[model samples]
Target: MSYETYAELKQLVLPHLQPIGTNYREAISGEQKLVLTLRCLATGSSFASMTVPFHMSNTSIARHVLATCEVLWKVLQPTEMPIPNEDKWKSLAKRFGDLWDYPFAIGSLDGKHVALVNPMNSESLFYNYKGYPSIVLLALSDADSCFTLVDCGQYGRVSDAGVFQASRISQLLDQERLIIPDESFMVSTTEKRIPFQVVGDEAFPLKKNLMKPYAARTLDTIKRIYNYRHCRARRPVECTFGILAKKFEIFQRPMRLQPDRAITVTNACTILHNFIRRRDGHMIDRTSEINYEIRPNNEQGLMNLRPQQGGRNSDEATEIRDLIAAFFNDPRGSVMWQDQNVFRNVLLLED
Candidate 1:
């Protein structure tokens, strides 16, 4: 929020966070706190660096950043995502490479570990390939790369499958309830209406609502095109992750704070990112002020593989090689997949 914008927001929300402190130091004020946090997020500077510019103590800055994030996170996280219904899953199958549309139409489920400095206890649990200990943030990103669902705080040792199993979404899938709204329909003898489903890597199981891509088969064109198109759309969450890790810089390195608090801050940043993106950063293109994680080298995307799974030999290179081949084959790839809706709804247009 800018200077005037901050003033306006304070007035509108004034009735809400009245300061218990007689002075600014006593209790966290409202807008000032928000302003400080935004500044920290945008600048990605150290607390020591921010203390002078924001005119607050290091401890105070940390408190406000955490407190403001807590409040905003509750308001930002989507309790329910839009589009698709229980009855419509089959109907929408044509839209996703002839695959049955389940609960989530074009969601891509994946886990990313944000590098953090090793903590004191430094359990082996948090260490990942980057050679640093960090927490795991598993998310379900739509084709547009927007994170429709997110789960954080798991130690890095937990795999994507493990994170999903422990998530509320996993529970819903197990119960046969989809995340769609009240208006959607459910069929068969059962009265329960399962909403949409989600897409994931090979690590996840295929139930009523979750779908995973085959890791092998570079020669198969259909699955290859399917994977390519989905990834083109799904890269947004990666883009979002890139922005958070880079601009916030704190995330690029091992976070020294308590793991739980670090998770909170991370989630808070994600929510705020979506909020900002919703306002102005909606497209996964260049509109964002921060974009890290350099583009994959086409000459090397396939041959170059990011090693994972405890230093065991990885076949991701071959899979990625197939992906590049599939990408060039798709007409939709020409559009650059700026919005995920393009892929989710692409099959609809052709049909």
Candidate 2:
């Protein structure tokens, strides 16, 4: 929060966190508690380390951080990461189209592993394929890079698709409980309709409401163009994760908290990230952030291809993808630069 906004927020949350008094001794002030919690989050200091400055026991520091985080989430969740209604979903899609030129895109989805020190007696559960002990922080971010929905504490070992499949939001999406509009939008001048959907990497399975890039092996111009556009649309979520990790240094290093506490801290950081984005306006577009993993030649498949699970129904996905490819190839929906940028060297190679 900015210096100007801190007092206002502190006042709003003070009533809930204020300690009850019995005339025996004065309790810690809410401002002090908030400061300590913010300090720990900003610095990723261990409870023991924070005790020195706060003049409190390690246990007290931990308790204060967890309790304050719960309160922050409870009060801030409705505004920060409220469930998307039809109008809001449409707004998100509209923004995606305006900024990224991808129509009917709801939001971008991705997962990142927050490193953790091994917990007592349960080491194997947190061990990930990257050969580290951590927990997954799967999130869906909007066009402006604010987190719309987040699910933390999934086992680090789980693949992006697995973490998504087991998430509560997945259950909601599968049962159509989110009420994501049954609406479709025109992707072409001829009125080819494509459903509004969230885009993810190849790790996520394709559904009517979710889209992923086409594999990069083919030489077809249409598929390559579609893949390039889809990858661009998915960049926001990756940028969100990048900004979140950069802002919260804890994610850059292994956290020494227990699994449950780690979840609380992770959720707290995510909530605070949105808080800063909303109040402080620290949203920066990192679209040009250099990623060595994705070279310009085959940038379409930058999002790694994990084993696709739980789908034998990619027929509709394939059809929609083909339609999008056709749209990009058409003169109406085609950007002027795409023809040269996408097919520049390919045509030379063909010749």
Pairs clashing within candidate 2: none
Reference-based TM-score, model 2: 0.88
TM-score of each: 0.63, 0.88
* Cα displacement (Å) at residue 54, model 2: 1.1
For each candidate, what is the lDDT? 0.54, 0.77
- How do the residues 1-351 of candidate 2 rate in per-residue lDDT, one tens digit apiece? 688667766866788898866788788888888898888887777789877888999988888888998887887788888999988987787677767777667899889898988877876888999898988988888888889889898998899889999997788877778767765654334344566778989898877677888777764778888887888888888888887887777777899888898898889888888878777775444322111110122222212223234656356666666776776677766676776777766745543
In angstroms, give how far residue 324 of model 2 lies from its true place: 1.4
- Give the backbone clash total of model 2: 0
Best by TM-score: 2
TM-score, candidate 1, is 0.63
